[model samples]
Target: MKNLHTRRHLLKTMGSGILACGLSGRSWGQSAESGVYGKRAAEVMAHTHENFWLKKRDLYKGAIDKDDPDFIWGGGVMFSAVVAATRHDPKYKSIMRKYFEGMEVYWDTKVKIPGYEPSPTAGGGNDKYYDDNAWMVIMFLEAYEMSGESRYLKRATEVLEFVMSGWDEVGGGGIWWHEKHTGDSKNTCVNAPAAVGCFRLSKFCEPKEAPKYIADGGKIVKWTTKTLRGGNSLFGDAINVVTGQVNGGQLTYNSAMMLRAYTCLYSLTGEDIYLDEAKKMGVAAKAFTDSKTGQYRDSIKWSHLMVEADLELYRWTKEDYLLKRAKTDCDFHYEAWKKEPAKDLITNGGLARQLWLMADMETAAGRDFWKKSDKLRR
Candidate 1:
């Protein structure tokens, strides 16, 4: 509860105080390591926020067809970051509204899918990406929670059902990554978030209808864990439905998505099974972190989602090391941002989210982890 309030304050101030001015490009020139936990983190968060609002608004501008918010199913990743930014600040309300409207721009209404195609009559994006649609449901659920809009709630439910249509017994019970008979694999990327969608969307449903989503979430989790669980409690990438070929790629986002799903189930059922699994995934995620290097060896595009899970785990377990990783990860990102600008809203918005979360964590635990008023020697 305190974290919620702190974040709300952090975001509100961040929107009005930092984003109000044209604080574009860089917030601080290179400096030595000195920080007041409160101010420095806000400075960094504002810098990241500017990259999206000023440098790369095209990612969610919602005016284009080819690069719409739902482009390639990664738009929702940026959407999640914006949703987090708004969690504690009302100044971002208008920006958040545009994001909701952006989804409508991508919706293929006649085809019952919400994704990018050139036009309403273009009839191309209707190929149906279950994973993309599932990701939409998750974002829509959050939109509903934030705005209390019945349309978002309805959209989420509709998308959830649409995503579930890809589920079949062929791959031992998991949704295919895409629809329209094109996809051949059952993916952890899809199933893990699909489980999360089921659990969260249940919040607005009737009691009779709610538990069913819980069960469905459990089913998705069971299938994914059984199929994708790798050594050290982390998850692998995907499996071919027909050939039974497993692509053993370990990604941070996949592991984080499962961690999120497990946490949702734990919160829903108050069951140790869910909490224990979440904890296992949390501990296993250490494989991606290198404290000595202040770096994580994974897709930078997805690190934002991955560390998002780290923050979530720290919140529940009060684990110091997880928080430390989160702070160190920010240090890693600060260097990364210095070398190259964030190429998309996912990286920019995600960086904003983690910095914001670090601020909230600092407030809640009386810690000064993100002392980013300093410059890295690199």
Candidate 2:
């Protein structure tokens, strides 16, 4: 197809832009607070927007469109980044419509509880894991907050119903990994982000109706902590429902999502315990770094969430060390980019988004990066 050919050409022509350690940064990350590096990050974000997402059904795949069935979970994190990039600068405003259309490509609205589908979903198929739908809920909420669009909120609320459908008496309390795989293990990936969704959904609703959403989120978080708590202030990967056993593995996003949930709860209730727990998890996440090479063990996509958690920690404490750690981790990724940059949509998009996020945390030019919109607010 014409699109596929163009994609191939674009992918091969990155030549210099992609090799400058993600846009010619100065002094590793010391200038993260300055506008120069922030602008460069925005440029990288723009490159990703052009190469992979000008218009495509499969946002997780390469520059070209494809009928991919995998990585639906990564789509949510990518969507969050997309929505954030659009809000961070008005230059990305062109992306908003394309984003909605791409969502249309993935969503099957005819289902009982409407949620997204894989690319080119046949027969309006609603089949997917609960975690994937939960990821979409997070993105839709971001879109709503960023655009102040009621439709985004309504879509997110509908997806919440579907996500809650994933929960039951299983494993004492947690979301099923997939809808059809009834006996599958309950995963922290689903539980933590779903908790974050519920927390955000609470505020998205009316004042009187908000309490139920909040309570639901609190209950999910409570059950998650009690059911599969890991040592060293970290969390595990999953728990086998059939065998009643926990898979004790720590991942960056799992810890990051919990950190977000805890931070949200603290902000809403003024609870120091939530903040304290988040701090513990933040500390544990740094164990990924190799003191010798200064390289991080986490892949770019997964490690981005850790950077997000670190930024939140920085926000709360105003600690320079947290920012420095985040900067170093980012530097590690860019340094790798100089040699072998990932060409896939998830990796490139994720790296750009996280780098921009880190730079935004320090620079006043991006002061409103975490806010709904950093631009002139349309």
Candidate 3:
């Protein structure tokens, strides 16, 4: 009887705290009416940005290798710049410049396989992964747009060519996942990034300059949609080449990639279907969240899908609910990190991703900070 009374008292105290924070049921409604959601969302994004820069600077010292998927570091840089641009940050441009410079050495290097040992001894080996090349091109194109640098654009164009070389009709006409090790198997992961690459490429490539690429991008988008839809409408992380059986388990990371691809396609074509698909994916991805901790598992049940999806969602939609959820998730992870900051599985990469998300979110919200920095840049 005493324990039950204690539990009730604790519940009452917690409920009172919620009320005090102005986060109680009625307060949430009033806050939304007064645009509190937007304000809070921005705050969350700003917090994310500060944390990301601090962590990334500590982790990386030199240029990341282009050949290894694990070493594909340009995406974070590009994402950071995007958030910076959204907030109008000046430092973002400098960070972007550094990232571009680090990646510039591999601009002319031949495309490498997606998952192969990086050779320090050999100069150019042929283990080209389509997704890696596609993402790299996407990053370069975004950087070019942010900086108006012809060099970034030029590098993006070159990378696009390399990415296109892997295009072959497999799994009913879509981009192959990998080049060196290829069969009929296809994955949305590869196709989505390729679609983004093509969308970005269209911006710089003229009808006369690279008509084939423009056409190829359209075909790839069509193929990706058809393949993804034919199987489940919701994409699988990967597919078996010979059997054509899709691995239907949903992953938060790839879903965001697909959402971005669809959104980009919508941006290019003004198609309602693409936009609708993006919104649908956004809604579906919400299921990835853990209500108690607010963190997203890497994959739904089996795969340890990390915080990457949370970052992607925050990037895709500036929705307050998503931002709040991301904040809670980041808080949960950070608290966990405090306990064990260096545990390989839970710490290094996971913590890095969590911090990146936090930084990205904060950067998204730091509009005033960005304006001040932009003024300094001028």
Candidate 4:
């Protein structure tokens, strides 16, 4: 019994040591390559570029389709443009134009109100996902910043007006996750981006009203802290007042979204609470990553969520560790797909994700491995 107790104590100590190491930033992977930062940036751009083409062909019928909410297609465009800006690639500009064209159609057809419909046939086409629109607006605004286009900014403002329409009295003040009949479900995924959108939008709008955006963002952050906590950490999902629970499972994407929101809030207000939450979410996300293999598991789909988290952490903290892990995880997933052809592994989305990671890795490491079709490029 004494020996067993001793073993348990030793294991506990080692575990604590590992956790401390992770928090202290010593355990985060560091690349030894020169020009790693630039290489990873370029690699990420290339990957996004490839994914844009693949997703366009397979997911959206060769162009930004108008059958669905503009936000969905807008997200792909936004993500692609972000990569393009980072890498200074011109192809992304063309992709952004396609996305903008789709949004123009959506703006023309969508009811000029504060809500959106997920689909045309569902719920009288009067519903909207708050975060979806919020993220779309953010993407558009960023695109404007990158390209200096006034149309993008105007469209983004219009979307923001729609997003604010969903704000109601619920769990303090948070944007409803959805706006159809199920507008009561206020998940972190929806609210976080809403808060971020409000804060970011204020920067381009009137300064007098900027306080309102800041206040709204603060309220959402507070509500998230009060309602989204399970034990001492953020809940993987939440129960909506109208729809009960939309997402019961922990998703790496959701977590990263939350991180993005928190970081935006921190940047806007210079608040410590937002910064603290970002760090906590960042660390919690680290657990989803395989330390031995450096692959991030998709907590919801069993697919790798490394790319999402990598981009989130990179943008949030500008830390090299997150980028390194992203590269390693991409390499692992690519190799796995090569060895066994799973359905998910063979999809355009999967390949695009892999290529994006590889490109980002190369950009950061300043190494060109696209020519070599080995484990790195598999």
lDDT of candidates 1 onward, in order: 0.64, 0.67, 0.49, 0.52
If both were scored by lDDT, which would come out higher, candidate 2 or candidate 3? Answer: 2
Between prediction 1 and prediction 2, the one with superior lDDT is 2
Candidate 3 local Cα displacement, residue 20, angstroms: 51
- Tens-digit lDDT track of model 2 for 1-378: 453343223323421221221112323236365554456466666666665553445344453354452355556666666776765676654465455556566666677766666454644564667878877787788778667878788888988888888889966878888777555789888898898888777666865556567667777787777776676767788899888888988878787888887776665555466677777777777776678765457787777777777777666656565666777777777667657656666777667767767666555545554543311111
lDDT (Cα, tens digit) per residue for candidate 4, span 1-378: 453343234333323222232322431224334344344444444543443434433223222223223235334433543433433456667666765564333332435573333322322355457766776776666566557778877877777787778777754556676766274477766666666666666666654556566566656656665566444344456656654454456656566666766666555444465566677776676666766775676621323333654554554455666666666665665456457433321232344443444444435321222112111100
- The candidate, 2 or 4, that scores higher on lDDT is 2
**For residue 325, what is the lDDT in candidate 4?**
69
Q: Each prediction's TM-score against the native? A: 0.76, 0.83, 0.63, 0.67
| Candidate number achieving the greatest TM-score relative to the actual structure | 2
lDDT of 1 by residue, 1-71 (tens): 45334323432332222112111232221111333323434454455455444223334522221343435
Q: Rank by lDDT, descending?
A: 2, 1, 4, 3
Cα error, residue 59 of model 2, in Å, equals 5.3
lDDT at residue 96 of model 1 (Cα atoms):
67
Off by over 4 Å in 3: 1-70, 73-95, 104-121, 182-184, 207-214, 229-233, 299-320, 338-378
Give each prediction's root-mean-square deviation over alpha carbons. 12.0, 12.9, 15.5, 12.5
**Judged by lDDT against the true structure, how good is candidate 2?**
0.67
